[model samples]
Target: MKATQKGRSPRGILAFVVAMLLLSGSLRLGSIGIAVASSTTDVDPKLGNVEAVSECVTDAETHELMELLKARSEQISALEAEQEKRQIELANAEATILENLSRVEEAETRLSQTIQRVDGASSKDVNKLTSVYESMKPKDAALLFEQMSPDFAAGFLAQMSPSAAAGILSGLTSEKAYTVSVVLAGRNANAPKQ
Candidate 1:
């Protein structure tokens, strides 16, 4: 009876080992490897016991679990790096949009100033410009004239005292005058007489 009782402890140990295996079924990593290795390995029959086999199997599982966790950590790090790269690219695109907006605003300001200049000039103002042109050096007059609408300059010239107009006309090279004449004849042909 005592001998039967001692043999029964091995059965209890087997039950405990099976219980651990069931509980650890959901645990991650080399579960297949340990089950296969333990089944195939020959036990030193003298040391063979369910407790020892369970402990050895559990140790193998722990190492495999650590390796699995390390792999997952590395994958997570790579994903995080990719996310950061995309965020930086998005920020750079936003900065480029802001820079473009600033440039557009500056261009709009310059256009508004040019509109104001055209709006403020008058027929009298136009006539004064011709006198100013006749008094200046030819190169200075030409440069200033080039900046004005050719039609505006033409009418101003027509209103000037003939002598003053003649002086300025003589100052211009024919080629420069021809270009101004072409401009005045084209899109600005019907431009205000003023």
Candidate 2:
């Protein structure tokens, strides 16, 4: 009878169940033996809280991630600074362009005024010289014209009456007359069209 009782002992059954509960971690053993048990088929809300054990990140890996984040942040800062510098340079260039344009306009105005004054003085001098030549005898005027350079003589002839200019040219040497004639003809060749 003792041998048969040992085979069916409640203590032995409790010990076996306790060992399974500890290994599986889905059950608990109480003083009464197998107080709570969970099977694969059963749905328990507490099962969602269970977590599998996993290895934590090493110190080296943590340090590498921190360095990568720092590098990225520094790169972003540098890009922002470069962008700001470019914007300032562009603004300065625009200001300089505007200033140069204003200066060019002022220079153009001054040049135009100076040209007008020179033209007025030149016209007055030509009129005075023409009057003086007209008052002199044709022979005397011809003598003076022959001594002038061909280009200079051509300028005076162009301002005179056709009859007066012809008298003066007739007095000159044939070669001098032809040279003066050519200069007068080609004088306005480079004049711009309106």
TM-score of decoy 1: 0.32
User: Per-residue lDDT of 81-130 in model 2, one digit per residue for the tens?
Assistant: 99999999999999999999999999999999999999999999998898
Clashes of each: 0, 0
- The candidate that wins on TM-score is 2
**RMSD, candidate 1, Å:** 14.8
Among these predictions, the greatest lDDT belongs to: 2
In model 2, where do residues sit more than 4 Å from their true spots? 1-63, 185-194
Stretches of model 1 off by over 4 angstroms after superposition: 1-58, 122-194
lDDT of 2 at 133: 81
For model 2, what is the alpha-carbon lDDT of residue 102? Answer: 99
Query: Residue 39 of model 2: what lDDT?
Result: 20
Whole-model alpha-carbon lDDT for candidate 1: 0.72
Q: Supply candidate 1's per-residue lDDT for 160.
A: 64
